[model samples]
Each structure stands twice: as structure tokens, then as C-alpha cells.
Target: MRVPRRRRDAVEVNLTPLIDVVFLLLIFFMVSTTFETRQALELELPESVSGVAQVSSPVTVVVTAEGDYRLGQRALSADELASRLSDAAPQAREAGLVIEADGRAPHAAVVRVLDRAGALNIRRVRIATAEATHTEAERP
Candidate 1:
């Protein structure tokens, strides 16, 4: 029996399929990604009369240095915040809100954020603060 010879041209990979997959992945990420937009705005908060305690499961609301507020990284206006709270899940609504205020932030700014959350039927609100750096133990 005579042996058959192999073809001179080798198989080649098509780039179009790879490009199509990349485009599809790009679109998928754009559509499915959840964006939280508080990186640009910051709110500073004045010290409170009482110490702020940590909560395990709070609806974290960050007040920036500029007094702008964000909820778990999602920015919100006063009215929108109220509306959003009203529309949140039961657990979300019940989840006490932790308001992170910068040291330089005005008291009024922090109050306003709390007021808005209150208006949305949020019962519990907590402010955020780090351990005092000026405590007697740490001082020389």
C-alpha cells in the first residue's frame, strides 16, 4: 500500500473569535458591574459629645470632607437618600446606619445626614470615629 503525504499548509488560529470574546467580556463587565461613586466627595465631621461605637451590621453611610454623603459607596442627595432608604430591603432599612464623618466636618452636616435617614424611618444611626490618638496612655 502507498502512504499518503501530509498537506503543505498548516492550520491557523483565527483572531476574529478572540476579538469577539474580548468585546463580549467588555460589554458584560460594563453591564453587570456595580458602581459606587463616593471617591470624589468627602465630608468631615466634628467630634461628638459621646463616643461613637462600632456596629457589626450597619448600613454604612460615609460623610466626606466636603460634607457630601455616600451610602456604602453610593452617593446620594438628601431627597434621594430618603427615597432610597424607603425603598431599601427590610434588613437594609433595619440595618442601623453608620455615619462616618471626617474630623473637620461640621456638626450640622452630620446632623442633616442623620435627619434624612431618620425621615426614611431609619431608627438607629451611629457616627464613626477612630480611637482618640491623644489619649493619656499614648501620650509621652
Candidate 2:
């Protein structure tokens, strides 16, 4: 008598579960990630109803609550600020000037920076402000 042979079927893998798990992991990471802004100086900016977004990178001058001046991370005196503004006049004139004055910062300090920028012939000047909160805006 002759012996009979049986044929086997090819194996197949289902990848739907693996693809679902990968998509879940991607969504989890995207939801858990946080985006934060870092600044060289800590400032509590005043709230404003009509603040506009700046389009260009301009020369930034930070005035702290104690009325200290900081050009980038370096603290500068009144005279030093004038000299530095003079040195950066060309760039300032082109990109404009941005003054970030803390909410508690002295008015005199901000004025001095404005005066220096004016003398340097930097006409385009903007003051940095935060958006008004809902509660604050609702108050009379």
C-alpha cells in the first residue's frame, strides 16, 4: 500500500493590535508633554487690554522692580545703558526696541530706558505687557 502526504497552510501575522498600541503611546506622549517659556529675568508684566504681538526680534531692555537695568543677563548702570544703546544703535534702529518692565518696576527706570532709546534714534519702541485676565477685565 502507498502512504498519503498532508499539505500545511502558510502562517499569517495580524498587526492591527501592534499598530493600535503604537498610536496610543504617541497620543499619550503628545498629551503629557508641556511647553514652557524661559526668560533670563523673572518679571511680572502688567496686564493690558490692547497689547499686540511682536513680529520681529528687537533689542530687549528689562527693568526690574528694584529699577535695575539688564541688557540680556548683564546688569548695567544708567551711563552704561546709554553707551550700550549707542553701540547697538544700528541694530536697534532696524529691528526696533522692546522694553520689558516689571509691573512693580519704577516709572522712572522705564522712562530712562525710553529716553536713551530715543536719543539713539530708535524710533520704533514697544512696551511688553501681559494679557488681561477674565476676572480683571470684568471689573469696572
Candidate 3:
């Protein structure tokens, strides 16, 4: 007697479910992700050839063209700035103070900050400036 031969069928994987899952994940990430816009004062920094690297988390004083003062992101009056600097003397002495003054900022404002730093005896004070691209002679 002859034995009956068995027939085999080709196996296939269904990818519709996988494609649907991938699409769902992509949509979920797209919907859950957040986009934030940063609002800041547009400042043009003075150029210098001797600018050094900033300290780690130094006390930053921002002087605007309008002569407004910002101490580490908070706006402060001269009196408040003086008081705050006095209060932060110990830390500022160790880490230093960074003065980020706009190119068009008042000379008096910058001088005032420097004088305050001088009063505090904070020897590590630094003036922040952008790197100068042109030579001194090239500048008018």
C-alpha cells in the first residue's frame, strides 16, 4: 500500500498590526512632546580680545542699554543690587561676579557695578565680552 504524501502550506507574518502600533506610537510622541519659546532681551555684547571662560554658576549682573539692572535674571534697583551683592559677597568672592553689559549700555551703569564690586572687594569680577573679529586698526 502507498502512503499518502502530506502537503505543506507557506507561512506568512501579518504586519498590519505592527504598522498600526508604530503609527500609534508616533502619533502619541508627536502629541505629548512640548515646544517652548524662549523670550529674552536682545543684547549686543562689546567685543574684546582678552575675554576668558566664564566661571561655574557665577553671579551674573546684566546691564541693559536702557540702564536696567538684572541680577541673575531678577530685575533690581541700584539699592537692591548693592544690598544683594553685599549679601552674596562670600560666595561671589569664591566664584566671582560676571558683568554682562550691552555694547550700548551706559558707561556709568557699568562703572557703578564695577565700583560696587570694588567695594565688596570681590577680586574675581569679570567683564563679559564677545570675541573681536577685526583688528584694533580695522575698527573705526
Relative to the true structure, candidate 3 has a C-alpha RMSD (angstroms) of 7.4
C-alpha lDDT score of every prediction, in listed order: 0.68, 0.85, 0.85
The residue-by-residue lDDT of candidate 1 on 1-140, one tens digit each, is 99999879987999999999999999999999978533655443444445756655546766666666666657787666666656663555677767777877666778887777766676776767665546556569
lDDT of 3 by residue, 26-94 (tens): 999999987633238777999988777665445878899988888865788888999988988888898
Q: Could you estimate the TM-score for every candidate?
A: 0.54, 0.68, 0.67
Write down the worst ten-residue block by lDDT for model 3: 34-43
| Runs off by more than 4 Å, candidate 2 | 1-40, 135-137
Alpha carbon lDDT at 34, candidate 1: 70
**Model 2 TM-score (2 dp):** 0.68
Sort by TM-score, best first: what order? 2, 3, 1
lDDT of 1 at 103: 79
Candidate 1: residue 18 Cα off by (Å):
24
Model 2, residue 21: distance off in Å is 25
lDDT of 2 by residue, 1-140 (tens): 99887877888898999999999999999999875333457899998878887774457888999998887657888889998888878988999888889999999999999998888789988899989885564788
All candidates in order of lDDT, best leading: 3, 2, 1
